[model samples]
Target: MNTVPVNFDFSVSSVEVARRLIGVTVLVNGVGGRIVETEAYDREDPASHSFAGPTSRNITMFGACGHAYVYRSYGIHWCLNFVCREEGHGAGVLIRALEPNTGIELMQKRRGMETLRLLCAGPGRLCQALGVTREHDGMRLNTAPFELLLPDQPVAEADIVAGARIGISKAVDIPWRFGLAGSRFLSRPFGRSHK
Candidate 1:
């Protein structure tokens, strides 16, 4: 796999940067996988967490780039987001799913099932499978235990699909959700355009 540049440019729009994440490898511990789905959220976007401004829970979102903005969703499952949009920019690219690459046994064990389709198929499930939680909050992606490595070649643009963001009540019309076209690992509603 080709690794992305050490100095990942984060000064661009989240939409453009989000596309760079496709086909990248996300390694946590001995487990690893290729990112297949993601959602871009900008601080100025009403549908984003930082739109309301940073607080204790979202402070990491306002920190340096490439850090993790992990948080619990619905007070139950942890979801992982990579901080983007330049330094001190409150935005992120939500990792919605992964295509299991390494440590399949570990992933299956953590998920309590053998079905590949169901494992790491959603944001919460992927985090659970990779042991990502609040403990990894603010962790830099350039280090071990948690890293995002770009491939030698990225997914072709023709193979990617963009649509409205899901699981949000606001900014419902924003076409910030992106994923590998027709990938089975994508979360539901990914194909649904903003209505």
Candidate 2:
């Protein structure tokens, strides 16, 4: 693939950014892979962390775009999100899953498993496999330990799938989830009419 001098313009809507991230490569210290699944959330969305306004945990989401908003999920696993929209917009795209393409051995070791498909199949799992933690929060995506490389070409719209986000009680029907079509690495399969 052709590597170009490009940066993700996170000043757009979270849904737009999430959909466009399908084929991008997210390497956390050279350990990530093609982005396969993502979910979008905005300040107005009830399911968004910023819906209730900025808090200590979600302040990063209100900061400048193109920054990391890492947070712990269920008091256990850490989840990674890319802050999007304009400054103080409080929008972000959650990186739900990835197709492991680099540092396979290291990822397997970190996750304590050898299954390739299972290594980065979920947000928490992906974070664990790539060593993403609180330290990565508020960090610039273009800086060290965070290399978000654009795809050689834009991913075709026909090759993408959309669906409702997973594991959320509110806004359960909003079609904010996006993923590469037929990607086995998705956190979960898209449901009917979700495309």
Candidate with maximal TM-score: 2
lDDT of 2 by residue, 1-195 (tens): 222226667899999999999999999888999999999999999999999999999999999998999999999999999999999889999999999999999999999999988899999999999999999999988788888888779899989989889999999999999999999998889986365
Q: Candidate 1 — worst ten consecutive residues by lDDT sum?
A: 1-10
The deviation in Å at residue 137 for candidate 2 is: 0.4
Go through the candidates in order and give each one's C-alpha lDDT.
0.83, 0.92
Per-residue CA lDDT of model 1 for 1-195, tens digit only, reads: 233357567556677777778788898986868888889999999988899888999999899877788999999999998888767679898999888978999999999999987789889999999999899999877776776677778789887778987789998888888888777777764665431
Which 10 consecutive positions of candidate 2 have the poorest summed lDDT?
Answer: 1-10
**Model 1 residue pairs with clashes:** 2-152
Measured against the true structure, the TM-scores of the candidates, in listed sequence, are 0.92, 0.96
In model 2, where do residues sit more than 4 Å from their true spots?
A: 1-7
lDDT of 2 at 111: 98
lDDT for 21 in candidate 1 is 85
